[model samples]
Target: MRCQPRYKGLVYIWLKNKQSCLLCNEPADGTAPICMACETELPWLGDHCETCALPLPAAGLTCGQCLKQPPRFETVIAPWTYGFPVDSLITRFKHSAKWPFGRLLAELLAQFLQHRFDEALERPDALVPVPLALKRLRQRGFNQAAMLARWLGASLDIPCEEQLLKRIHDTSAQQDLKAEARRKNLRNAFALAPDAPIKGRHLALVDDVLTTGATAQALARLLMEAGAARVDVYCLARTPKPGDAT
Candidate 1:
C-alpha cells in the first residue's frame, strides 16, 4: 500500500524519450517484460477514501457509504486499478483461458499482500478464492481466482483449500450493474460447502478484481458466521468509481 515507486519511474523516463535505442526488452511502460514505451498506462489509487479505497469526495478517509455500512472483509490490498492493460490482462486470463497467469498472479498477489498488510498477511492460515458457480465454471472453463489462490498459497507456503466456500447461485455480471443493484445481485449468492470446514482459521480471500465489493462482503459475513476468526481481502485490482451509498 505504501511502496516507494520502483524502477517504474526510471522506465517511464526512458519511454517518454521515444528513442529506438531501448535498454531492456520489457514491455515499454507496464509492470511487464517490455521497455517503458510499450507498457500500458495504469491508474494508481491516490488520495482515496480509506473505507473502500475509492477516489473520495476529494477529501477524507472513510467515504460516506463506508461510514454508513462498512464492508465485512477486514483489510484490502489491490495493487492496481482494474482498467486498461490490467483489465485486458484479466479478460485474457479470465475469459480467454490464459492459465499461466494463475501462478504469476499468485506470487505477485502474495508479494503485494506482504507489502500492503505485512504482518497481517503472514497471519492468515489459508488462502481462499471467491468461488464461481457451476454454470459459470462450465462456461468460463476455469476459475481464475481459484488459480490465483492456489498459486499464492503455494508461494507463501500456506495451504489452499479450494472447496472451503462456494457460489450457490448464478448471478448476472456486476460489471453491468449499478452499486445498489450489484449488492442485491450478490445477495445469497454464496454458501459454504458441506464437506469443507474453516473453523478457527484466519482466511485470506483472493479475487482478481473488486468493484462494489458486494460479493466479498457477503462472503466475509458468511465466513465469520461460519466461524472464521479473521478475513482479509487480497485482490489484483479494486475498481474506483462514483457511487450513491448502497
Candidate 2:
C-alpha cells in the first residue's frame, strides 16, 4: 500500500506488509509503500496540551488537574490516546509478535515532536526507557516500553542509555489501583544508576503510555534526586482516568 506523492516523488510504501493487506503478499509492491487504506488509519494527534498531551476540553485550561498539580516529568508528547487503532496497533506489535509497528509508532512520535519542537531536536541527549522488573520481563518475554525507546532513539538519532534506570521493586498492575494509591504502589520502585550520573544533562524518559502517572512520577523523582538537570516524558499514549485501558 502506498500513497503517491500529492504530486509526485512522495511515494508512501507498505502501510504494512502486503501479506497483511486484503491484497496479500510479503513485500506487496512497496513501490508506493503503505496502501491507501492503511495510510488513512495512521493514528495522528492534533493540537493538544503540550504538558499532558491529553485532548483539551474545548475551552479548558491545562486539563484542570495539570494546572492544579503538574506531573513530576516536565512534558509529555503522545501521538494518540490509548484507544482504537492505537491500542490495537500496540497490542499487535507487543503481544502479537509483530515488530515493524514499533518503528512505525516511533516515526509517528518523531513527527509529533518535530512539529512541536523542531529546535529542541538539535540538543544532544540521552533517552532512558522506563525499565521493567526482571520478573515481568521474564513473564512477558519483552519490555514493550524498552523496544519503543530503542526504535525512537534510532529514528531520532539520539542515544538510548538503555540501562540507566533500574526497577528496584516489582510492582503489581497499576491499572487496578486508584490514582493516589498508584503513588504508594510505585513508591521506591525505581532507582538511578549507582555511579552513572546524568547530572546537568537533559534526559527523555520513554514509555508506552501514561496512566495514573504514578510510575512516571516515581521515575522522575529518582532521576532528579540522582542529579539530573531535567527530565521530560515521552509516551505513546495516555489512558484516561477510570475504565480506560492502555
Candidate 3:
C-alpha cells in the first residue's frame, strides 16, 4: 500500500505556496515567504563562538567549553538563536506537523548558508541529517532533520545523504537532561550506516536546533573516527547559554 503524506490535505500545499509572511501574515516582500520587516525582526544570531555558534557577548571569540574540550565538528552555522517566533515556529513545525513553517525556515537558512559559502566557508561535499530513532520517527510521522536537509540540499544544489547516519538507540530526549547527562545519554546512540562513503568527505549535519552540542559532537566524532575529513553543523537556530536569556 502507498503511504499517506504526514500532512493531510490541500491546505499543506496551499500553505507551502502561500506568499504571506508566516509571522505577520502580510504579503512577502520578495521570493521568500517572509517579508523584509519580519525577517529583520527575527532573532538573528549575533556575535557568537566561531566554532560552535553559541551566542557570545563579543565577536570572534571561542566559548570556554570549546576552549577546554574541543568538539569534533569544525564549525556550526546557525542563523538565529532559539528564541521568540523562531522557537514557536519550530515547535509547531516539529510537533504539530506544520510543514509550511519548516519550509520557510529551511528556505531562509539555505540563503544564509549560501552567503557564508560565498564569503569563503567551505561548502560541504554533502549534507547529512542527524537521524531520528525509529521509535521517535514512528511517533512523529516525520523526521524534521531529514526534511530540512532535503530542502536545503535542493536550494543549495548539494546532495543530501539522509541515510548516512543511523540512530541506534532511543535515548531519552536531550532537553530534559543536563549537558553532561546529554553526552552520556548519546553514548553508543549513533552509528554510521553500512558502506557509508564518508571517508575524506566534508559533511555538514542538518537539524532544527542545537542545544548542548551533545548530539552534534557524538555524530561528528563517529564520522571522524570512521574517516570523514571534516564535519560541520547546519541548523536553523542555536540555543543560548543555559540560564542566560537571548
Q: Could you say which candidate leads in lDDT? A: 3
lDDT at 203 for candidate 3?
Answer: 97
How do the residues 1-246 of candidate 3 rate in per-residue lDDT, one tens digit apiece?
A: 759757443242333444777688798776667889999999999999999999999999999999999999999999999999999999999999989899989999999999999999999999999999999999999999999999999999999999999999999998899999999999999998899998999999999999999999999999999999999999999999988888
Q: Scored by CA lDDT, what does every candidate get?
A: 0.71, 0.70, 0.93
Residue-wise lDDT of candidate 2 within 1-246, one digit each (tens)? 767535432233435333233212224333333344664555555445656766654423466677888876677767777777777767787777556666566766865676656755434388889898889888888888888888777767788887888988999887778888898888888877778767887888898878767787788878877777878888888766565332
Per-residue C-alpha lDDT of model 1 across residues 1-246, encoded as one tens digit per residue: 968845443322322424221223333333323343433244544566665666654746777777898777777667677666667667777887755344444555666666755644446888889999899899988888888887777666778888988898899987899879998998888989895677878887888988888888899999999988888888887777744321
Among these predictions, the greatest TM-score belongs to 3
lDDT: the better of candidates 2 and 3: 3
Candidate 3 clashing pairs? Answer: none
TM-score winner between candidates 1 and 3: 3
Q: Going through the candidates in order, what is the number of backbone clashes in each?
A: 15, 13, 0
Q: Rank order by TM-score, top first?
A: 3, 2, 1
Q: What is the TM-score of each candidate against the true structure?
A: 0.77, 0.79, 0.94
User: Could you tell me the TM-score of candidate 2?
Assistant: 0.79
Q: Looking at candidate 3, what is the lDDT of residue 6? A: 77
